[model samples]
Target: MRLARFRHDGRVRTGVVEGDHVLPFEGDPGMLEIIDGSAEQRTAGPVPLDDVKLMAPLQPRTLRDFVAFEEHVEGVRRSIDGSSGVPEAWYDAPTFYFTNPHRVYGPDDDIPFPARSVDRDFELEVAVIAGPEQSIFGYTILNDWSARDLQRREMQVSLGPAKGKDFASTLGPWIVTADELDPYHEEGFLDLWCTAQVNGVEVGRDLLSNMGWTFETLIAYAARDSRVMAGDVLGSGTVGNGGCLAELWGRNGKQDPPPLRDGDVVTLTVDGIGSLTNRVVTGPQTGDLPPVRRRDQAQARAERQH
Candidate 1:
């Protein structure tokens, strides 16, 4: 089943998409309702899809995105640090980071590039929403927006992708139930054809099979000493090779094609799952920010934790 969340008649609603129309669910069942198998009932008839404004599929309980592709890691390292190989520890296990679930965008939405950063990039990926028993409820296209300049500074602190990434994420058009993707699944990995484009020009294309770790491994690794509840969303990080603009191919870590700018449109598409597109816009205003204090004026010693 393909389910979508949209705004119709001045109200946000949940519905099932069939062809060119949408069948609104009774009482606006959401992600939780569908996952629990309770979103079966629907309104009397179907409504044309053009009547509603689509929204980001769901607001996840937790968002965890992983670097599950070796080629992506290698390319990113070369782009950012002028490095040649991935860290050995990366192969030890699938690693991920928590991103803000509150800020999300849907298809056709305008994505504001972070005002403080000059380098803008987009990551093409697929994200799965967890259902009952931590199983995948559905799949959707994900565009992880990035401000590479902020990311570079943040990572230098050895504790980041926070200020850089917590800005925004795009998901939707609709969610395709897991069973619908069975034809593409092979040994816990999907062989989906994925592609990314900016301003109608193709930037990258890759197969999901190129990922270094499977969703199962990501889920299991995430569950270590923690619970992965329903509604949690996990991303299959940037697809390897030329999956993102940050994959530099220049001397001294310089970006070749340059970063995204205002008026650029980014679209990510995956076979079976559909596509998600957003336009770049000027973000909110910037305010005065104080830099870190000098080392001499820094704290003499670390304080004990509470």
Candidate 2:
């Protein structure tokens, strides 16, 4: 079953998608309740999908994203620091970073270009929402918007990516339940094709089965010292060879392409899951934010003090 959250008849609702229509729930059955098996699938009349505004299927309690693709990790490392070797720790265990849950966007929404970000890019990925008893409820598309310049600077501190990634994330068209994908499971990975498009041009493609670490393993690691609650989301980081300008530039010997510009539309699609598209728009201008310090300036200032 495909579950969707949308605005209909001047109110928001949760419903099951059928063909091109949504069978509206008789009551507001929260997504977590549905995942926990407490909510019934009773429905009212069908509402045409085109008639309602889609919303993020659910607001997750927390979000963890993992780098599970070896090729993607190697490519990213080579792109950023000119190294193709995988870290020993990465092979030892699944590693992930927590992101801001409050900054989620829905399919078809306009994503504002972050302030001070001149190298905005998009990451095409798939994510699983947790269900009761350590199970996966469903899968959905995730677009992890990044600010490359900011990311490169902050990661030098030995900390994880922060402000560059926390500003925005997009999910959904709808969630395809795990049971629906059971037939495609091979070994521990799903046999699904994922792709990304920029304004109608295809830029990247990869198979979901290419991930080195499975979603189950990633979830297990995440729940090791804590609880994984219903509505928690775990993202499979960028697919192998996913094209972000950072990777593309490195492949082309460091010449940059124009970063995401205002009015550009980005679409992420997974074979079984639906497509998620968002338009990039200019965000509020930076009013009085301080500029980041340059390395040269900092060194010169230290010499003067001595």
Candidate 3:
């Protein structure tokens, strides 16, 4: 079953998507609750899909994004850090980072470009929403918008992808229940093709099977010594051979194609799930916010002596 959270007649409602219409439920029993088997799939009336405004399928309790694609890692490292190979530890374990859940964007929403970014890029990925008994409730498309310039500068500190990645992440259109994808499951991996398009032009494509680490493995790693509760979201990072402008430039040595600009429509599609489309719009200028600065260790020691 495909489920969606939307606003109709100025009130937010949750519903199961049936074709182009949604079978609305009476109360707002959050998507997570429905996934946990606490809420029933009862319907009230059908609402036309075009009449309602879509929202993120659910408000995630926590968001964890993992780097599970080797090609993506290699391409990024070679492009940004001049490295020809991945880190040795990456082979032994899945690595991930927590992102701001408050900045989530739903399908058809306009994503504002971060003020500090000149090189904005989109990461095409798939994400799983956790349900009861450590099982997956549903799947959705995830677009991890990145400010590559900010990310590069911050990584120099060896601590974070912080402000660089916390700006915005896009999810939804709707969630496709695990049962809907059972046909595609084989040997613990779902065989689905994921694609990304910029303004209707195909830019990247890859199969979910290309991922080096499975979603189950990534979730297990995340749950170690930590509670993986309902509503927690785990992203399957960028797919193998997915193209961001940086990776394209690194591979082809062509920089003529510009980075994401205002009015660019990015669409990510995963075969079994659905397509998530978002537009890029310029945001309000950053006023009075200082640019990032490097801390001088020598100057700090001299000040401590005083």
Candidate 4:
């Protein structure tokens, strides 16, 4: 079953997506809101999916993204220096980040380009949204929009990814339950094609099976020392050989990083997982953009940027 959170009338509630409509899951809030409820007992309201705005299915209590793919890790490192690869410890330890939940956006939203970013690029990934606590539910397409310039600057200072990666991280039109994609995790060849389209033009593409680490390993590592709540989200950093900018933009080492311009639409689509489409817009400004108003606007804005 595919799950989502959306707005109807004036309230924001969680729902399940079936075919062309959205089924309202009115119970508790967050992942637990739907995870804890039964689909058999769910009395759904049919809202034309086109009319309802989609939000991230789970309101992640703790959002942590891991670098499960060694190829991606190595590519990023190589881009930084002549030769940079994943350390032995990285294979042993599950590396993660505490991202701002406020930064997460829904499936069809438009990601905003921070004022600081000049070069904004996309990272195509398959993020695993945990089922109950430590269980690996299934995978969803992820677009980790990056500001190359800021990231490089911060890395130079050795206190990186702040502000650079904090701007936005996109996830899901629906959280594909593990059962649906069963054999992929265990038996048969779980081959799925993934691609990225910028304003209808293909910019990147990759295969789901190309990653170095499996989803099962990610789950075990994530739950190793700590407890992952029902609504928590874990992201698969990026995929092999596909770089929206690291290779395309030459790592911003040569010149100014390219920022996402207004009207640029980025679509990260996976075979069974569906497409995660978003537009790029400028963040809100002062004068009329108050602090509280900005944050509120950001949240609302995030819903559309996804």
Residue-wise C-alpha lDDT for candidate 3, range 1-306, written one tens digit per residue: 899999999998899999889998767777877877888777888889999999999889999999888888887776666677788988988999999999999999999977768888888989999887677888998988988888888888888789778989988989898899999987888899998889999888889988887788887888998878878999998886654666665565544356899899999999989899999987778877688788899999999999
lDDT for residue 73 in candidate 4, whole number 0-100: 73
Per-residue CA lDDT of model 4 for 2-83, tens digit only, reads: 7777777777876667899987764525555555433333646678888877877666676677776676676666565435
TM-score of 1: 0.93
**Backbone-clash count (model 1):** 0
Cα displacement (angstroms), candidate 2, residue 262, comes to 1.0
lDDT (Cα, 0-100) at 230 in candidate 3: 73
The estimated TM-scores of all candidates read 0.93, 0.91, 0.93, 0.81
Off by over 4 Å in 1: 38-40, 249-253, 295-306
lDDT score at residue 125, model 1, on the 0-100 scale: 94
Q: What is the lDDT of candidate 3?
A: 0.85
Cα lDDT tens digits for candidate 2, 201-293: 887889999998888887888999988988899999888765455666656556355578888999988888889999998688778769977
lDDT of 1: 0.85
